[model samples]
Target: MSTDPASTDPASTDLVSTDPASTEPAPADRARGFEAKPGAIGSPPQHYGNPLHEQRLLAEGTAVVDLSDRAVLTVTGPDRLSWIDSLTSQAVAKLQPGESAETLLLDPAGRLEYAVRLLDDGVSTWLLLEATEGAALHTWLDRMRFMLRVEVADRSAEFATIGTLGSPSLAPAAPNGIALHWRDPWSAVVTGGHQYSTAQRHPSADWTYSELLIDRAALPEAAALPAAGTLALEALRIAAWRPRRATEVDERTIPHELDWLRSAVHLSKGCYRGQETVAKVHNLGHPPRRLVLLHLDGSEGVLPVHGDIVLAGDKEVGSITSAALHYELGPIALAVVKRSVDPALDLVVTAGDPAIQIAAAQEVIVPPDAGAEANVPRLPRLGAVRR
Candidate 1:
């Protein structure tokens, strides 16, 4: 996905959408006094008039955010687990029913192609992903199943994703006999995964975000719950240092750059596409770029947008991949910058036409030497070696 700045118009394809074939608005879109988000990559409401209050309610697990624009795909057959395990970054060959796992699809070079949130209910494995990725991912998976028993199908029209900070009162849809709820794994390192952030206490330690899948027809019931909006969700997401594929990924992105190995990549997993590069970067070298959090100076009362240039003094060091105005944190952003950029340097983001610079305070998420986890011993200089 482009990760470009988006518009607030509800009908704009640049943000969010339901089924393209359905001309009618989604049930959630008809909520009382819904205000669509202009800059969201998917078409979800920005808020219900009181964004900050919504954020507080959401953080307290008293509110639900509509994520109907996210796509749902299903893979089934006896060969499903092993088949997908061999093709993606996660180790899912033995995934238990109702367990959640994240994975990535990469090119041979290990650059991100797609990011998927997976849940298996025994009979079928459900893949939840960005709406823009639905068709392409489904097509790719189908084509790759040349002789495998696995079958792939797009089920977005039948189900919708609803976001919450933690367990909500709303029941998940069980079209397949098992309730579908995807708990995010960002709060801690999963087994076989690695963490690159040096923070003594990770922000995601408090991130209880999860997605509940529901039948499309049940959206009105979901909307009737104490509801927040995508804007509220985005603010909390940024504050948690979560890496979302739709806004955080780009053409050159690799797992190491964003410290995605913490949840999405299995370092010791069996052979899979991009494993070589994943291994090489983690065990031998540092990623060229590192993800960071920027606490923007909100004195100007302006918030930056996606693709805004990040500057370290006069030199361009990075670009803001995601930005939001948090209820507690004020204006903040997630940016990917050159690993060499001094984390101590004050940064600036240039946003809007006839651009104005917004001062940013840097907070490192991925350190400069994030990889080389193997601790390979350095060889002594030939002449300095003791005889």
Candidate 2:
């Protein structure tokens, strides 16, 4: 019943009991009716049969969303922080233990490659990301650790990620002498980051998102608690105007295009792989495209899907990246459209196989004038004499 990118199939491997303390696998594995999220990342339940209710409970901070499928990686050794700081878009060389930071790994052209949620425990730096990004990110990081006193490893098999709208009553597992909880930083602008959204009050102001890492063996118990599905999580994410790397990004995606600078990009950070383009775009040029939230018309009781064409009149301006039926918002979506599209104009989205046109009203996320924050004064025309 849900179309989230995180819902589909059944997990191939059974999350069986591995606790040395108990011989029985936690009953949660069998009782929770868990199914594989889309792309078969890991078997996570889509819902507990009532998505709307689950959304309500999660919003109330009484529910936990199982995110076991997400990939976890660890960087250890003396150079862990500085080594990774030199590779991503955040100034995390001095990230303190227990601090949370979000960063973007961009291609040489400043296009997004990976979005990493980071937490350090003094002994190790943890990288939490989408399931699909684990292998590639691990491979790349491992390759880049040439002469540095650091080491990287894919720790997905050892730990699982559990998401909560806020700190839940149950504490996260402390496997390696540290509570692996990561508080999201998207609610406000970071120290060296910039905000592109001009909203008087950003929806993320109340987004108290946090992720907890637990032993994979403990999944059964965590799943047994008050639980919600990925569907509910995706809906809330769209409403908060939060961007996800797996859904909001494309080949041409720059952090500025998604208002990601507010949390992920450090405008004054030292050189990195894509530093030149990031600097140029923020100082002199506008990103070619921007992100928007679509208040979709749900009159037909239909929700748009990823890749659905978004249009202004007859011209296709962009495509829907993520869409969902929010608990309170009816139907909503996040789309990436040309920065030139007038924010005042209502748009259309065509969904389904035969394609039914759905009217969508735009809620600006990234404005048309999002970049070139340097405030360079405009030079007058040479031929025209000054008055």
Regions of model 1 farther than 4 Å from truth: 1-42, 380-387
Runs in model 2 deviating more than 4 A are: 1-30, 33-41, 379-387
Candidate with best lDDT: 1
Q: Give the range of the ten consecutive residues with the poorest summed lDDT in model 1.
A: 1-10
What is the lDDT, from 0 to 100, of the residue 253 in candidate 2?
93
lDDT at 262, model 2: 92
Worst 10 residues of 2 by lDDT: 12-21
Cα lDDT of model 1 by residue, 56-164, tens digit: 9999999998888778899999999999999999999999999999999999999999999999999999999987889899999999998989999988877888999
Q: How many residue pairs clash (N, CA or C atoms closer than 3 angstroms) in each of the candidate models, in the order given?
A: 7, 2
Cα shift from native, residue 144, model 2 (Å)? 0.8
Candidate 2 per-residue C-alpha lDDT over 1-387 given as tens digits, one digit per residue, 9 for 90 to 100: 232323322121111101111122223343453332333444466665566777888998889987787899999999999999999999999999888999999999999999999999988999999877899999999899899999888888778889998667666766567789999999899999999899999999879989998777676677567888777788788899999988889898999899999999998889998999999999999999999999876655567777889999999999999877676766778999999999999899998757788888888999999888789999998898987
